[model samples]
Target chain A: MKPIIEITDLYFSYDNKNLAINNLNLIIYEKEWVAILGHNGSGKSTLAKLLIGLLEPLRGTIKVNDKILSQETVYDIRRETGIVFQNPDNQFVGSTVADDIAFGMENQQISREEMKKRIDKYIKKVRMEAYLQHEPHLLSGGQKQRVAIAGALAMDTKVLVFDEATSMLDPQGREDINTLIQELKNDGDKTIISITHDIKEAMLADRVVVMKEGTVVATGKPTEILKDETLMKDCGLDVPLTVKLSQELKKYNIINDIYVNQEDLVKSLWEYSLIK
Target chain B: MGIQFDKVNYLYARGTSQEKAALIDIDLNIDLNDFIAIIGHTGSGKSTLIQHMNAILQPTSGVVKILDKTIIGGRKNRDINIVRKRVGLVFQFPEYQLFEETVEKDIMFGPLNFGVTKEESAIKAREALKWVGLDQDLLQRSPLNLSGGQMRRVAIAGILAMEPDVLVLDEPIAGLDPQGQKEMMEMFYNLHVNQQKTIILVTHDMNYVAQYANRIIVLNEGRIGFDGNTWDLFANYELIKKYHLDLPDITKLIIDIENKLGIELDHKINTVENLAQALVQALGGANHVR
Candidate 1:
């Protein structure tokens, strides 16, 4: 089985003085949901840019779908990968929501009818069909992100990368995006990579890759990695609020599973009561 | 030092074709020395409310009274500087606001703007740097050269150097990693506790409010959804759901367990330790009853 993403001894630097990324190595399987966790300037974003071909690696190679990443092949790799940035406002090139989604298909020289159908399709998928005619700047943060996602999804890219996409969203919006990402993973087709600060979101990913300074320090299942208090603290993150509450409820054995989501915790507590 | 919002109303892009009413008829008061946390969805008027506190924005209607004087009562062309000096606001991703060549100069900009001499501002800049846990040695270094976390701290020190009576930070830890978030939270806590400054933190992260804030204010559709302690907010599970916000996972777990097994676990758990103790007590009680 071939990995969807393969990075070996990949090094990146913005300037001669500071190497933004150390000799990092990573491999992501196809159809897997992976989250790269790190604080700002931890080089996760830089890593994301490198994967998408926005930034060239100073040393080493990145192979996506067995194609070695280089300046020449980057544009081709980008055709298969779609990235949504942290600031939705900066990513939008079209004035209206619909126009933004169509921009990708237009660049790909997709047929007019096919383009129109996809624009209609993804806009409704993100529940932003009503705002298709609205200007990007006029929308709220969540709405802008929804549009950004619509644009990305419309591209029909095999690999979807969200770079702190939910940071700008509110709680409800963040949850909505989380649910959407989970739904995408449920399809078991598209490979998903989300670089995020929210530990809860990381927990939802199949694997959480913790980055510090510029290299991958630890990578494992969310359940296993999230429990490490020292690693979490050192990474500039705190446990999910639900995890903390579950820890509190451990005395009663009410909330059984130590999870990142409060809803699961609540359901477990309810079940525990019935069995007891 | 208390800030009062007296039936304030504000509109975004007012008098323009795209205008939207963002804040509506807000009436609340925050006492001095309080660690107040505002939790709201984006565009819920939380930002509009905070902008009114320091007269950075004037209410389209109603009044904002900070330190007993109406924020909009004074002439905009005169004496507004005093109001700005009294309330130091750190906007989201505040690192973007840093522009000085060096950390020391950046921190001193606030005090120097208010007429502090160069030498005095340097001393105050050092004090502020110390307050945020930065070393004096980094003073001359360009703020751009510092780490992202350090750059943020430098931006905050600039605010602290102003020595504002009330410090307002909007989404201060929006995208930071766990460690940086903890350090920033501790810095805010220390500033409020050890330094005796009042704080108003606008955040979506309820964990911060649950762990630190003395009071929590919820905003929904430009109105006060709830204003109470963390315990009160968590206890009313329905409101949490209605607002479309998830309960901290642990609380949900306890509630779920209670529903499934019919056990009485503590409903007021906030931290991991509290939930753990509550779980033990409830289990013990259930065993005794059995």
Candidate 2:
């Protein structure tokens, strides 16, 4: 399949400051869940903004759906690429959930009936039907996040970007969003690029891209990238809990490889015990 | 000599139609130099409960003691300056609170307002910047010029410059990258370890709380549901699950080991490296055998 999103040597910097993203290159396959990981100020957000033309790159190009991303195509890019930001309060423009979902469809010039249909579809999709009439301020952080997801998913964009979307959520809320993201990936042919500080969340992605000092340092399966002790330390991170547990269980020689999921880790431990 | 909450109850939008209890009959004591981690599910009133620590919201029907002064010292008895100075509450996304032109000026604002001399404030600002791992050169630049993580550090540095006795942070690493999250935690750990400053952090990372915190306080439904040592919190998996809390995946892994292999781990495992080392030890020093 042709790559859904392609970045060719993209370079971006603040209008009045130094380069934030430098010589970034990647090709995101359609329907792939890719996570972008980096240290603070490493240009992950800039790269996300660059991909969707939220911030114009100082150089190079971004192509989504095989269309070049430029000023002329910025609106179409936005129309195709949806971004859910970190803070729920900032992304929302409407006072109520119903109005918030309606805002996007309204901007897209979607018909009222079609808008309601789409709104109902996504609100149900995110499981926030009851909160459709609640004020944004009245909702908790996780509720607001679900509403944000509803707003983003309502647009039916081909590419979904989570800009640290689950960072504010409590563990349970984070799990809720994580499950939702996996469901969305399983249920559709959309591309998901989540920029996050959560290593566990990154491990759930199909591929992990590590960024350092405004550059792409490594890209591979999350297990390969995360299990590297040198890399994890250099990136100022610890291995994911599941991986750590497997490594810990190795004391009893119960598990061999470092897997990032509890089910797999447990199954491996049981098998190791039988062999022992 | 630190902070105390005695039968404290807090309500949001108090006396209004939207009034709802945010915190219910809470009696807790956090002593000087205590590093406490506050954990809870969403809508559990964790945020609102922390806001009361510094008089951001006084108790609606109870008493909050901070640095020997009660927030509800009465309508005519308000010690705003002392309350604000003694407890530095770093709100979620402190970067948004940055309005000063330069990073150094922003860091100096709290200290200067607290009546520190110009030279002393600058020294404090520099020290705070170093603690957060931000370069001294960046102090001359606008806070808006810094990166997301850098801006976050600058905001934190501003709070640290105040040199408060108690530091409370609400989801400090909520929007950071994994590396940034680690750095922020290390900085916070150092703040408590080296400086002996009382730290109360509100975070959702169960694994992080397990590894770093001395005490874990779980809030549920605007009330203190669980409070104990971090190990005990995880040791009682039933209680953790009852309160909608999760253990570090590693701890769960250990539990799985006991269930499936009929062998229980004798030692607590929190870090991957420590677990890996312990595993090798349990496997009879497998230096010669892979």
Best prediction by TM-score: 2
DockQ for each candidate? 0.49, 0.53
Candidate 2 has an lDDT of 0.82
TM-score of each: 0.90, 0.91
Local distance difference test, each candidate: 0.83, 0.82
Residues B1-290 of candidate 1 have per-residue lDDT tens digits of 58888888888887899998888889899998999988877767888888888888887888788785675522353466787787999988788888989899999999999999999999999999999999899999999888778988999999899989899999888766667778889999999999888999998777677788888889999999999887788888789888866565556666766776566767776656765666656655323332
In model 1, the runs with Cα more than 4 Å from the true position are: A230-276, B11-21, B72-77, B238-246, B285-290
Q: Give the per-residue lDDT digits (tens) of candidate 2, residues A53-80.
A: 8788888888899899998989888888
A1-276 in candidate 1: lDDT tens per residue?
A: 459999999888898678889989999989999999987888999999999888888899999988998878887898889988988678888988889899988988999999899999888888888998999998877788888988999889889999999987778778778888898899777999999987778888999999988999999998878877688878776666666666656545455457665567666655654566
Leading candidate by lDDT = 1
The digit string of per-residue lDDT tens for model 2 on B1-290 reads 77788888877776799988889999888888888999887778888888878887777777788888877623544656778877899998889999999999999999999899999999999999998888999989999877778899999999989988889999998877666777789999998898888889998777678778899899999999988888888888688779978777667766765677566564367766775565555444543243
Fraction of native contacts under 8 Å reproduced by each candidate = 0.70, 0.69
